[model samples]
Target: MLPPASQFRAQQKRLDQFEALTGIKTTYSYVPYGQLLDKITTEAVGGSSEYDLFSFQDSWMASLVGYLNPLDASIAADKLDMGRYPEVFREACIVGGKTYGLPIRAHPQLLFYRKDLLGEVGAKVPASWSDMVATAGAIQNKSGISGVALDYVKGSGFQNLWLWFNCLWGHGSDLFDAAGQPRFNDAAGVAGTQAYVDVLLKDKVANPGSSQFNEYDMVNSMAQGKSAMIMVWWWTYSVLTGDRSRLKPEQVGFAPMVRFNGGKSPTLATLMPFGISKQSRHKAAAWEYLKWVSNPDLEVEIVCDKSDPQTSDIVATQTATYLNDKVNAVNHGLHRVALESLKGARILPKLTIWPEVASVLETTISEIVAVGKPVKPSLDDAAAQVARIARRSGRHRS
Candidate 1:
């Protein structure tokens, strides 16, 4: 599991407790995500015992799904019991006609706003793209507060590309064609890009520094009431609930994205996937490890981690974590309701290439928006580069 340091320690404590209870001995170590994935890949491909169980960001599921063995029978035959799990998360394991992972954290994106500020402005929370734009402008024009914080810092322009792409996909546009080809230059994509860009450029509804502000900035901005609203993932609820001691918890609120500019869009559910290596002689132990790590008790610890790690594991099926009292107290109006909204969320491409392709597209977003270049040509260039990446990786683009 690739959580921050505090999370690793607390989870380690729980895992240690689990081993004693189950009488199944095991050991674990922590490393950076890139280092861990690289080591595991080398071992799995080389057919060596490089690792056993793994937890990773959702994007890699499509690529690794083909390489790992199915666990449906493992659970069905009593090696583990699937019935005890939340169905939503359990299904995320089944990708490309195979069961490859479990949900360690269910990552869902949401729109966070200042309920008090909206009331002071006599404005209602936006429920559509048109409404969101208008809301942003209204807040900025009237309150001198940016309507929405740009959550794009740390290559946020890069992160925005993927989140924006999800909105595009939900709006009936595809960044790429079915054969793993890039179509970001297509009319729908161009239109989507224009609409997304308009929020920052034409509409002035978002923070001007959004291009430079990463999630940390968004956290500080929103937590301190700098921005009236922000779109962010589920786990942010932790830091968002606290402020610089001056701001009380009552300042924040959460809500599902009202709608894309087109009226409605798909809800995207991002998950951290759990997997067992094909190279493990302890396949049974690894499977048991997944079951143990993901048990409701342990999963809740991951979600509502009271630890300093802030590693809330938002498992695939557990929206209950969305209803924490502390989170609700910070922003009562939207937290739980927004959590329930996750049930209808959609998963993006599970292919391994998405990580690289997404990175390419994100890097291009700032370039396109900065130079006043049109999205179509920029996307075209992005697509070609992504295709070349796929070819070089020794796999065809999906």
Candidate 2:
């Protein structure tokens, strides 16, 4: 798990409770995001691992399926309700019709904006991509601040892709087509990419520093009152209105991600699920831990617990938790907004070669956004590279 250390410690505190109830002691390892893929692959290749359970991102699921134990039997025996989570999240935990894990952390993009700034500019919350840009331009002209802040840095795992996914999908384009070939270089994709870059290049409504910004930098721009809006993960509610922010809680507002005109709105969703290691000696105990931690009641308790600063969390994976009355009251109705976003959210292609595909697209997008490269040609080049990767991996379909 990636750190603040405090967040995981809070989870460990709950695991301590699980130990008391089930007599199963638990410990966790924190790996930096960049190192997690290598660590998991190393452990899998070695045929033994120290951890009984593995917590990993959805993108890695296809590659790690062989190393993870299928949980269908356990879920059936326990009558576990996988329906507790949204469909997108549930789909991420399954591979080839087999349940491999349970989702623990999930996030959908939310348009976080300054209510006060929008009101000052007489701009309404944007419901479409064009509306968002117009609102941004209005805010920039009237409020004397960057209308929006976005992540567009060259590296750092291509956080910029998160922002672009909304545009690409909204334009009815996807990373891959029905035949399992790259198609984001198609006409719709080129148009979507053009619109995405226009904010910084043509319209000039984005924060100037965004050319070099990552996710943290974009969020910080909002917290420090340098930008009027940002489309970020739901978990950012705390940071945008917490002690570090320059604005008050009342001044911040949340909305669903914008869509293309007359097109579907699809926010890119993220899932972090825990899978039992196939080689684990205590698969049953690990399953018990998974059940205990994923309980909707426990998720609500964690989100509403303001007593422990380290353990307090706002992200919820279950529908019931998001709709909880008490949870909304505590977290400013963020869960309600999140539920709406997740209903139409999009997950990445379930491919073992996603890391490689992602790297190619990241570099292509970075060059286009940072160095003023042509969009269509760059996307075409990336598509060719991705096709080669798919072919080499023997995962290409037709």
Error of 1 at 311 (Å): 7.1
Clashing pairs in 2: none
lDDT of 1: 0.66
Candidate 1 residue lDDT tens string, 245-303: 23455766677765664544666666666688776778887877777776655654554
* Whole-model Cα lDDT of every candidate shown, in order: 0.66, 0.86
Best by lDDT: 2
How high is each candidate's TM-score? 0.84, 0.96
After best superposition, candidate 1 residue 9: deviation in angstroms?
A: 4.0
Stretches off by above 4 angstroms in model 1 are 5-8, 43-50, 79-91, 152-158, 243-246, 261-263, 301-316, 319-335, 387-398
Q: Which candidate is the best by TM-score?
A: 2
Tens digit of per-residue lDDT, candidate 2, span 179-215: 9888899999998899888899899999999888899
Stretches of model 2 off by over 4 angstroms after superposition:
1-7, 261-263
